[model samples]
Target: MPNTPERPRRISVEDQGPMLVEGPVEVTCADGSVAVSDRFVVAVCTCRRSRMYPWCDTSHRRRVKREENTEAEDGPAS
Candidate 1:
C-alpha cells in the first residue's frame, strides 16, 4: 500500500457564533489543558460565554438585550 498526504481539516467561522471544525478533535487551552471530542463536527466557542468552555452549548443564542426584555415586560409603549 502507498501512503498519501493527509487532507487538511475544514473549519467554518460564524460571525455571531462558534467556529465549526471537522473533528475527532483535541482542543488545547491556555492553561495547558486539553479537551477532546470525537464528534464528526465540533462547535468551538468564540464568545467565551459557553458553560461547556472549549465546546459550545448554544449559550450565544440565549443572549438577549436588556431593553428588549424590559419592553416586552412593560406591555409595549403607546
Candidate 2:
C-alpha cells in the first residue's frame, strides 16, 4: 500500500484567549526557539503574560479578573 500524508492538525482560536491545538506539537517561537509538547492537547498563550510562554497557565483569568474588580471598586473617573 502507498503511504499517505497525515491529516492537518486543528487549532481553535479565540478573540481573548489562548489558542487550543492538538498535540504533540512543535512550536517555533519568534526568537528562533522551539517549544514542544507531548500532551493530547495544548493551549498556546496569546496574551504574552504567561510565566510559561507559548503555553497557557491560566494567568489571563486571574489577571483580567483582578483588573476588572479593581476598576469596579474605583468606578469611572469624572
Candidate 3:
C-alpha cells in the first residue's frame, strides 16, 4: 500500500481574528507566488494586514486602551 498524506479535519475561528486550520497548507498568490506551511495548525489572516501574507501575526487584534491613548496623544487630529 502506498502512504498517503492526512487531510485537515479541524478548524477554529476567533470572534474578531484569524481562522485557524489544520496545516501542511499551500497558498498560491495572485502574482504567481506561493506560500507553504507545514505547521500543525495555521492562522489564516482575515484582516489582510498581516506582514506575513497568507498567515496571521496577530495584526487583526483590536487596539488596546494604551495604544488608543498613545495614538490620541500624537495623532494628526490633535
Candidate 4:
C-alpha cells in the first residue's frame, strides 16, 4: 500500500485573545466531559471567562466605564 501524506495542523495566537486552531477538533475536560467543534477554525479560550468553557465568545473585549455628568451631580441645571 502507498503511504499517504498527513495533513498539517495550524495554530494562531493573537495578542490578549484566544488561540485559533484549525479544526474539526475535540476537547476533553477534566471532569470527563467532551466538547467537539466541527468548524474550519476554532478558538480556544485562554482568559477562562467564556460561558462556553473551552470556546471563545469574544468576552475578552475591554469594558468601557460611563462617566457621571457634573451638572447632574451638582443638582439639575438652573
* Residues 1-78, model 4: lDDT tens digits: 222359677889999999998888787877998888889999998898889889999888788999989987899877
**Which run of 10 residues does model 4 get worst, by summed lDDT?**
1-10
Model 2 local distance difference test score:
0.83
What TM-score does model 3 achieve against the real structure? 0.65
* Per-model TM-score versus the true fold: 0.72, 0.70, 0.65, 0.71
Error of 4 at 26 (Å): 0.3
Report clash pairs, candidate 4.
none
- Tens-place lDDT digits, model 1, residues 1-78: 222359777899998899998887889899999998889999999988999999999888865665558677888799
Number of backbone collisions per candidate? 0, 0, 0, 0
Candidate 1 ranges beyond 4 A from true positions: 1-4, 62-78
Per-residue lDDT tens digits for candidate 2, residues 1-78, read 221358778899976889998888888899999998889889999999899998998767754433356556888767
Q: Candidate 1: lDDT of 48? A: 89
Reference-based lDDT, residue 51, model 2: 98
Off by over 4 Å in 2: 1-4, 62-78
Quantify all predictions' global Cα lDDT against the true fold: 0.86, 0.83, 0.78, 0.85
Could you give me the TM-score of model 2 versus the true structure? Answer: 0.70
RMSD of each candidate?
Answer: 5.7, 7.7, 7.1, 5.1
Error of 3 at 70 (Å): 14
Error of 2 at 59 (Å): 1.3
The candidate that achieves the highest TM-score relative to the unseen native structure: 1
